[model samples]
Target: MDRAFRWAFIGTGTLAKKVAREITASERHVIATAYSRNREKLCAYCEPYNAYPAISIEDAIDRSDVDAVYINVTNESHYEVCRQALELGKHVLLEKPFTMNASDTEKLQNLAKSRGLYLAEAMWTWFADVPLQVRAFVQSGKLGRIREVYMSYCAYSIGYAPRVSDPLLGGGALLDIGIYPITYAYRLFGFPLSITCNGDIKNGIDYGEHIVLGYDGFDVKMDVSIVDTKGEAMIIEGENGFLANPGYHYGESAVAKTKSGVDIFKGQRSYLKEFDSVADEIRQGKTESSFIPPQATLDCMRILDECRRQMNLVYPFE
Candidate 1:
């Protein structure tokens, strides 16, 4: 009910630090506390924001001044930490790979609903403006009926070495990076009727994957890889023409072409605009976030769950 929500960040890592920087730069929210098991890391992460670093996770959640908690920990830790925050009656914003599977995502959603608290998956890409524009183009009949979508997200992260290969940590191209392309497709087209995925696994974790999602009237083909670099774009094909996004993750611009001609749309970092939605949701005590709702997260998890099942892939936590 406060005019500006007080936020506690659960992980003092690189992503958490970036969120803190953005929160500091914004007026809608303030970083009141931060926590990590390591005191030094906690301090280093909170220094720029001038936030109080909690000695324990419980202390961070139990702080009366904190209105929301941002869970930016590892994939396996998302459910536990967010559960703790929601149990403490604090709204939660979780980093993606919301859970190791759909069951945990369902549990979190049920808990938040019962507690009258807001729980959002921080899939910032969904909140980006390019997708909204693309949606409008589809609905406007500018591209006619959407027939197919193609998305690819790939990058070389060999410098991380063992971390990239570690199965226990839930490390893989799919969960780590593929979620983007999959979620992008889902956001535009909804859950597919069926999915077939093939991946190359090294040390029991998928290093790269190619997924084919089939819908009633359309299909989606997506590829994600951590072993190599890709063009990293999304193409939404309609009956008439298609909309092409050169950079799907944080699309700086998009080009829409139809039987008529071509139209280009440009913008700044899409993630920043997405962050504003979070701020508005928390500040207003809104139960639902229009950006990425709980059901959408659940749907995404179900698709990932099916993909994992078909590929015979299981995370350590599962």
Candidate 2:
């Protein structure tokens, strides 16, 4: 906390640009280096923040100034890039879906553990307060034994995200927008007893999916899409009442209804919270995050692997 947290960014795409804007806005963080396949785009991304645009992935992480690496590269490159950073003795905060499969996720996790390097999946929902508050409300018995739950994170991302339909890039609705709802379910109910998935696959990639996570007493049904727009909504229904959020993944607030009355829970929604929290943890000499723990990430990846297996959604690179 005494010095600014320096970050080496491995990708300069849309997500990386947005995160850079937030990180540069604060004095506690700095984009010490950045890399991209496109040299022109990389330079453009680094100018506003006055960051050093590295020529390669190794150039970005090899610098002594960088305390951690923030990776938002193509999904297929997640494991290799994270492994490179950890091998270089730099902390890593990777974008989700952690890896293409659980096996690779576990490998990277074990590598970090063995080297005593900090590593985490940047699943921002848990860092937000609303979902945690909702979890607390449900656990408090205010929801009176949850009976059913449904979440939808469908959007027409095909036109904008060509990568969503590109199998070579590890593209699919399950890895794109699907991760939010899946991680949300895992965080609330832990691992499911049974996992079932029905998906629409076109041109070697998944366009959408209907996933059901079966628990002991109830079922959590989730719908995710890249070619269709079903609207983003989340609801946790219990014997007493239900909790609803219009934009569940990134929304700042939610409403809980019961026999007695209605209550609203609010929280901060900025992406910077995730980065700052990780930086602070690393600064404190912690190798793991309390918000997005290693076990939670591995569990979510296992669920994703099972869903992919059922849907037969395989990328060419995988």
Considering every candidate listed, which one attains the maximal TM-score?
2
Q: Mind giving the per-residue lDDT tens digits that candidate 1 earns over 1-318?
A: 536667898987777767666756766677889898899888887787778989888888898888788898877788899889888888888989999899999999999999999889998877777667766666688888778888888888745745456787677888888888888777777888889999887778887889999987888999888888875988889888989987877755899889999988766664456666786776777877888878888998998888888778887666
Q: How does each model score on lDDT?
A: 0.81, 0.90
Worst 10 residues of 1 by lDDT: 157-166
Query: Can you write out model 2's per-residue Cα lDDT over 177-265, one digit (the tens) per residue?
Result: 88899999988889999999999999898889999999989999999998778889999998899999987799569999998789899
Q: Which residue runs of candidate 1 sit more than 4 Å off their true CA positions? A: 1-3, 158-164
Residue 21: error of model 2 in Å? 0.8
Scored against the true structure, residue 212 in model 2 reaches a CA lDDT of 97
Q: Give per-model TM-scores.
A: 0.94, 0.98
Alpha-carbon lDDT of model 2: 0.90
Among residues 3 or more apart in sequence or in different chains, the pairs in candidate 1 whose N, CA or C atoms overlap within 3 Å are none
Using lDDT as the measure, which candidate wins? 2
